[model samples]
Target: MHLFSAVPRGVLTLLFASLLLSLADAHSYFIVTSPTQGTQLQNGAANRITWIKGLLDDIDAFDVEMSRLSVDGLILVARDVPAGSGSFNLFLQDVPSADDYYLLFLNSTSGVMFTTSSRFSIGDSSSNATATEPDSSAPTVTISGGPNPLNDFATTFPPSANGVAMPGWKAIEGSKGQLIGLFTAMMLCMAGGAFTLL
Candidate 1:
């Protein structure tokens, strides 16, 4: 009398396979870790930008952008940053002093904004102040409900001087290594269950 008992065995197997394939196609994203809310970065100083990547596949690189809350456009910070490198060293020399600066990470291949960092302030180069650590407990500022931020701004901002690739910073093995291992273990368990049922 079970509903699934009425379905053919091959049809049930096809349905299960389809479900697994859909799960494997999940989209990837990045989470900015450093320069969180209320962090004060000094101009003309080298600051490390770090992020945690989630299930990166298909996208090979990212374009970093900076925008000010008071200004009306975006600034290109870096281009073609490798997807696997979880950290970038940014040297802010020519950037103007602004208290509402935030960073945007875009997918280079797709031109889509993947994530944005919490707002951080940049001080004047002449100031004798050092950059402060990010206040972890501060609430993040979210930017939304506007025209595509990239539409008005041209790629005029020169790339930052330091592009030091820290590939080992929080490395997550090969891009697809973890996913492949997961699929293999799942299939083995499914096959074992099938044999037991038979």
Candidate 2:
């Protein structure tokens, strides 16, 4: 009457152990401390490249390097922080001659996951570059008879909240014309089936 009764007791024990290992290995989340993405900083500003790492159960320590990709390999290494410190800090002074540079965390034994987020800049002027954000103010419009409205919004607006297909795409989603068209199409299909049967 038990659910895993047909399985061998040893096999069940092994499965439970495997599940525990996977849970430990699969836990990680990183967040930048300061000078957020696409932020403009002083020429010699030693911005602390600190990041909050979530779930540090497995990984004790790892090296963090601020690097930029080159034609051959990582070229501009502003800072390379070695492991083994109670508290760790990464700092960068001179802005790389290059444009896009990112932080790379390398932990072979434990937590080596790196951030693939868009490159942040350190420059004199950030007037032209705008920080990307989602539009959270608008009250979304919904089609009562169709699929969910939030899904429709996501399919239309991107994460940057830029370049929607049409300004009225959300507002006009529940318009009578659209509903009538869908209703009419369904009725016509039903009628065609009835005529064939007759």
Q: Pick the candidate with the highest lDDT.
A: 1
Give lDDT tens digits, candidate 2, residues 1-198: 456557665675567556545654454565555446565433432333445555443333444434445422332222223222222322233344345666565542355555433466545323344333222432221111112223221112122323344456654653444455557556655744554444
Query: In candidate 1, which residue pairs get closer than 3 Å at backbone N, Cα or C atoms, i.e. clash?
Result: none
Query: What Cα-based lDDT does every candidate model obtain?
Result: 0.64, 0.41
Worst 10 residues of 1 by lDDT: 138-147
* TM-score (all chains, Cα) for each model: 0.54, 0.38
The window of 10 residues in a row where model 2 has the poorest summed lDDT is 139-148
Off by over 4 Å in 2: 4-18, 26-36, 54-58, 70-94, 107-118, 125-198
Cα-lDDT of candidate 2: 0.41
Superposition TM-score, candidate 1 onto the true structure: 0.54
Model 1: lDDT equals: 0.64
- What is the Cα-based lDDT of residue 186 in candidate 1? 87
**Which residue runs does candidate 1 get wrong by more than 4 Å?**
1-27, 108-110, 126-129, 132-198
lDDT of 1 at 108: 49
Q: Tell me which residue pairs clash in candidate 2.
A: none
